[model samples]
Every structure is written in structure tokens, then in C-alpha cells.
Target: MRHWIWVVAAFVAITPFTVNAAGAEPVGSAGALISGKSPDGLGTWTVRYQHFDGNSPVAAVINDRIDDAANHEVQHATWNGSTRRPWTFDATGTINVRPTTVSEIFVGQYNTDEPNMPMQSLGSVVCDSRSGTVITWDNLFQDKTSGLTRLSAEVEARLAPAASSNELRDWRRSGQFAPIDVNFKHWVATPQGIELHFPPLQFGRGLKIVTVPWASMSDQITPEFVAITE
Candidate 1:
């Protein structure tokens, strides 16, 4: 499952929005910010990624924003080695990259169906061109490095300006969390890249909002971008 050639874009749905970054607050009632699942509930997933280098390792195209309607129908997964069995949304999701050591490049929706099969390593990021929006994750497996290190140090101690009113009830009681060893291990990188804040996966009863739009990469050798399940 490694077919490459993706260039489909059109995702605009991010309501109940908030993000000013000063002393933020008020992110409730979007069904409580993004809803729970990590106290061993499994599947309520959330992951963010970014990677790119100078001379050009070829990685460009990043647009993450899709608010509501469970991220408005989208289920894409491509992690060749293991875990790729969740297709039933129909929008678009692709990650047919080729050069691994564990650094940015992960498509969401975790239940596993078998694609390349190789998950259990959640840490590694490195970008070139004077790193800016810093990213760095390392061998995170101890419950996603202690629950994203207590959720990135308590959501960066309330990043204010907007977006945080009990932060959607603290993501429906603990940030739609998940990372009690969902079986992911091994990965590396550090040119600069790492930012994972996952939480949104239920499939029934409420929300499964999986935003994260557009991402591109090419080493040449494509044909494996599955995320069209409607």
C-alpha cells in the first residue's frame, strides 16, 4: 500500500473557533472541546505533524482546520508496516511518504486494518530552513510521554487570547485523550519538528472529529492514498 500522487484540497469547517494566544479562555460547547477516550478507552486519537528541509527533501502543503461535524467526514491512514484499516468517511487523506526513521508524517484514525503496519513509535520531528513553529517528539511510549507530558504542560498554561473556557470542559474530562500504550514504538528525528495534540475518536454516540487538512511529500514511487469512505 504505497501509491502516491495526491493533490486534492477543499476543507473549510472550523467553527466554535478560538485562538488568540494571550491568556485564552472559552472553548466550551463544541460538544465540550473534542471529547474523551484515553483512560484506557482506546481509539479517541489525536496527532499533529510537520516536516520539511532546505535544499528540499520535498515536504510542503500544510493546512489544519476543520471544525465540527466530526471533522466533516474524513478518515485517512497510511503507516506502512502496520495499522491502516479505517476507511469510511470520504473526503481525502494521504501520507505515501518514503524515508523513515520516525520524524513527522502520520495520518490519523487508529483502529488498524493493515497497510504498511509499523506503529508504536510516537516521537520524532525535524525540519530545515531555520525552524520556526518548533516541533520535537521522542520515543514517546510511556503513555504518550506521560499523556503528552500532561498535555503539553497543561495546554501551555492556558494560552490566552481566546479558546479556553474550561477548554471544552477540559476536552470532555481529560482532552479526548488516548495513549496508554496503543502499541507504538520506535522513531527518530530532530532537524526540528514535533507537535502532537490528539483527541477525537468515538465513531458512535457523539464525536469523532478528525480534522488536519492537507499534507504533501514525494520521493517518487506512489499509489497508496486511501481515505474515501462514504
Candidate 2:
């Protein structure tokens, strides 16, 4: 990770508690909305980053990681030079699952410009708001081996209905698709299901969400996971 050195000040905001759906916890704080525009002579670039709690020590862990990656892309663009001018980077965070039930699921939606197409990356975390600690991915599954296998299969199946079956077939055989790993390293848990993202051209789809519903995976998920998603 590139060590971050500040050239621009980021705007930070802490949202006060607000009403939420019945049985759900109050909507917790929103992240500091940090944005920066390149100074003169660097060419034109802008960055939008959020979902970082400037007040919490642990929040920096996730925030800095994403920031470094985003900055790397910004630097890459300046060096490589995209066909399109005014390169951009956005790393916005969302609380996919509210902090109502002792836990909250947050996902970083990162986008950066490429020569021909925009690139996407994901970072997801499930935090125990009560404990102020992150809930590791492995802890969610009962039988880790089988659960992961099932999850990987579900992800593959999600892309089956897309128009680019030929490309999908080749992708399945490629190194990126094989040896499927459901590390939960890149996922967002919603009320309806778990959404895993894949970037454009992967399946000839602009962007893809490989959603696996909570019901289908009930057998594999731990009781704690059940509670969180419920």
C-alpha cells in the first residue's frame, strides 16, 4: 500500500442517529465525505471517498487501505495517460446492512478510469457495532469447506443467464475463475441476499452482481450469521 501523504483536505461528516425500520437499529453514522481535485500541472483528476469514521481508530485500517489503492490508480493514470481526459476515481462506502442487530455490513464501491473502460474493485467488511470489532468471514460458515464450494457454485450460476456465454465459458477455464474462493473478502450482505460484484467485459456485462439469497445458504451459515442477516 502506498503510504498516504495529504495534499488536499478531505471533508468529514458524522451523521447523527436517525429512525429506521421496525426491529432495526438506528441508522448509525455516515462516513466522512473526503474529496480531492488534483493541483495544477498534475493534469485533471478528482477523487471521492467516504464511509470512513475520522473519529474511530479502527476505521482508519479500512479507509487507508482503500485510499492507497485509489491513489495508486490515480498515479497510474497520470503516468499511462488514458485516451480520455480528466481521469477520475471514486471510492464510496455504503452500510448495506444497518447496525440494528449488533452487526453492520459495509461495502466500498470503487471505480477508476482505464484507457477504454472504467475498472471496479470491492472491499467489504462486517462489523460488530456492539463489540467494535470486525466479524471475520470464516466465522459466518458452519462447514467452511462445503459452504465455500456451494457459494462459489452459486456465483458461477449467476452469470449463466448473461448474453456472453462464449466469453463466460472461456472465463470459467481461465485462472481467474478456477479454484473458486468464497473468502467473503469481496461481498455485500443485503436483506435479500449476498451480492458479489464483477467488473465489465468479464461476462460482457457492464457490471454484474452475483446474488445468492440468504434462504439458499441457510444450511451452511452459522447461527450467528443467521442472526445478523435476519
Candidate 3:
């Protein structure tokens, strides 16, 4: 539940494109719609995307719409370029909308960037339709003290195999392993557990996703989130 302020100027122009995927149906003026019965057979969900432009003509435009029929909730994600410089934008990844005992969640990943700059990883965006909650990295822990310590230890153990000996030594020497420092923000929920995402340079040459089972860190997670994982 974050609030965003968008200011669109007159110079900007928007062109709509229709998406026709194999199993997708087109919703009324919305870009595309994809729906299915939940795995448990208790509910239904839909995902839609609308094409829109930013304030500037060169800006990137992409939006996501998620509907949780069982929970009667709707969530939206919108992204556009900020700078006037030449840019490249792509939202090509899987959009997973699934239901748990008490909630429906949506997760997505994409890439975007401008010239000469490193590719930006729109790592993962997750929405909980039941509570209308948007889970960010900061919300994962109960308290910064014990919660972060355990998280850092777990993450270090998982990433150690991929790091060079020198890199590992440097990380240990710094004695700081907070999620923010390591860029541990992108994440998604799976049937088995919650998966943490780390982009290139954060760990190794390419993207990395590490799954920490719900039972392993049950103590650190908030009460509300436990149901979704179950």
C-alpha cells in the first residue's frame, strides 16, 4: 500500500497495443486478461495490463492489473521512464497469480534501463490481495535486531557457494550483512516457500534466486504472512 504521485505533461502521447497470447483473453479497453481457477479449486483470479505513456514522449510505459476474485481485491503496478535520455524498457517475464488458504498473491519480474547505464532489474513485485498488502523487504522481519541477524546468516550460507574466496572474506570483514546493503529486495512466493531475488553484481555474474523455507524462519515472519505461505 504505497502511494505514488504521477504528473503527466501535455507533450506526452500514448498508443495502445492489443496483446494476443495463447491462453489470454482480451478484456474491454484493458490491454489483456488472463484468468484461471485457483489450484485449490476454491476461487478464481485474473491479470490484466494496460499500455500507457509517461509525461515525456521518450519515457517507458507499462502497467499491471491483478484481480483476486475470491478476495475481491484489485492491485495495480505502473512503471515509466523518469529521465529524458534515450531508454529501453521491457516487461518480459512470468506473471504468477495464485491463491493460498487466505490470500491471493501476484509476482512479476522485468528489465528496464537507459543508454550506457546497467540494466535495471525490476526484480519482483508482489501483492497480497486479501489484505491489500504490498510486501517490501522491510516488512519481512519482526525486529531489526534478531530478525536481521538471522536473515543475514541464512543469506550468507546460501550465497557462499557462489562467491569467490576473496569476495566472501571481504563480506565477512565488513561485518555488515543487512538486506539493504546486499540488494535483497526482489522476492516472490512459491508453493514450497518464499524466494529471494538478487540481481547481477549483488552475488555473481547473473541473477540469483534463493528460497528460504517458511518453517526455517517462522519466528521472524509476521503472523499475517504465515497464512499465505501455508
Candidate 4:
């Protein structure tokens, strides 16, 4: 099973509204949940991490919200706090998806402790899958409240279309996998949050996805904070 994480980077102030979609059912797959609705027929979601840091994992639950696209404002999010055990992270923030103009998604959380801190460059990683085609760059995680600067990381995903069809069968039969690398670029505040990028890699199959571990910091925003944004 593959772990799917959304990347949220937009923040806008507005009244919260509930997203209600008629005749919709809760989605079960990452692909479906990303493109599906809540079981309650709303546009919001409630996801729980069953086994975050464990060797074995359980299922994650997703609820619905009143509205679908509210910049940086998540409707609902939580962690069971038990399933994931000693380590756990969860959130309920805004989610945005614009397939036509941009196949991009963003989620936002407020860091109140500190703000206007200096930025720093962390590091990067390479994807093991050869069929994936996605890359992620994270930089705004300082403190949920203070918003200081401490650590940051980037992930680059490159995909091969042909690998999508056979990825399931291939990974299941062979434990060994292809490799993809992520590298740190720089930190700069702009309309698009902290700006950073990594060089692309050529893979033979599936799309690659990556994120910085924010929940790991005293105050930071991980890919879970942006899970619905990708």
C-alpha cells in the first residue's frame, strides 16, 4: 500500500461555510478520497492515522466538510491518538484543487507562537518508485504559533505513464524498487508561500510524492498539513 499526503500552501481569511454535496458517498482509496466526497455527503473530511510510525498500519477515516475549496481553511481533521501510537499528527485545514489551470492543492494552519523568523535550508530525498511523476517543496514550517525558522526539506517526484498500469503487480512481486532523489533549493517568502525546488528525475513507473515532516519539529507543518493540497 502507498502512503498519500496532500500539500497545502494557500491562506485566505473568510467566513467558514459547510460543503454539502447531494448523493455522494465517502471515498476509500487515496485517489478516490482526493477526488471524492465525505460519507455524510459534505465537502469536508475527518482523517485518522491508524499506524503512523508503526511497521504495520490500519485504515484512515475521512469525513466531509460544508464547502470544498476554501483557501488554507480545513473543515475537519483529527488523529485517533491511539492507532498511530507514540507518534501522531493530524489537522483540519482548508483544501484547494484546480485541475484545469493547475493540478495543485493547498492546506493551511496558523503558527501563532512566533513569526518573521529567519529561513533555513534543510535537505532532500529520492523516490524509490520508478513510475511516479510528482515532486514537493516545503519551507513555511517554523512554529505553529511563533512561526520561526528552524528546519525544511524538499521532495521531487518524476513519473512514467506506462508504469501506472503495472506498478501494483511489480512492487508486490519484487521488493526492490527504483530510486528518486530530493534536494534542498532555497527559502524565500512570496505569494506562493516559501519558494524552493529540486531537479527532476526520470522514472520508469508510478508517480512520486514527497513532503517535509513538520509534526516532527517543536513547531512545524508536515505534509499531513498539506495532504489535501497535492
- Scored by TM-score, the top model is 2
- TM-score, cand. 4 vs. native: 0.17
1-230: candidate 1 lDDT, tens digit per residue: 44322312222222233334662332211111222222222223333222222232232211222122123222122212122334221121211122332133233334455553232222222222122222222322223366444543433333322435665456446534333332112122322212232322211132222221112111111222111100
Full ranking by lDDT: 2, 3, 1, 4
Q: What's the alpha carbon RMSD for model 3?
A: 12.7
- Report the lDDT tens digits of candidate 2 across residue range 1-230: 12234433232222333324653332443433444444433234443333434456655554544455445445443444333345455554444434422222322223334344455544455554433345554676787777777777776777677647677777776633542453334565666766666555555646566778988788888876576556
- Per-residue C-alpha lDDT of model 4 across residues 22-81, encoded as one tens digit per residue: 622123212211222222232233221111111211111111111232211232221111
> What TM-score goes with each of the models?
0.25, 0.60, 0.56, 0.17
Report the Cα lDDT for candidate 4: 0.25
lDDT of 1: 0.27
Error of 4 at 88 (Å): 11
Alpha carbon deviation, residue 8, candidate 3 (Å): 6.1
lDDT of 2 at 92: 42
In model 2, where do residues sit more than 4 Å from their true spots?
1-26, 29-31, 37-87, 99-114, 175-184
Question: What ranking emerges by TM-score with the best candidate at the front?
Answer: 2, 3, 1, 4
Which residue segments of model 3 deviate by more than 4 Å?
Answer: 1-85, 101-118, 137-139, 173-176, 179-182
- RMSD to the true structure for each prediction, in A, is 17.9, 6.7, 12.7, 20.7
- Which residue pairs collide in model 2, if any? 25-100
Alpha-carbon lDDT, every model: 0.27, 0.51, 0.45, 0.25
Write candidate 3's Cα lDDT for 32-126 as tens digits. 34433322233223333332122322112113222222112111222233222332322332344445311122233322343435443533445
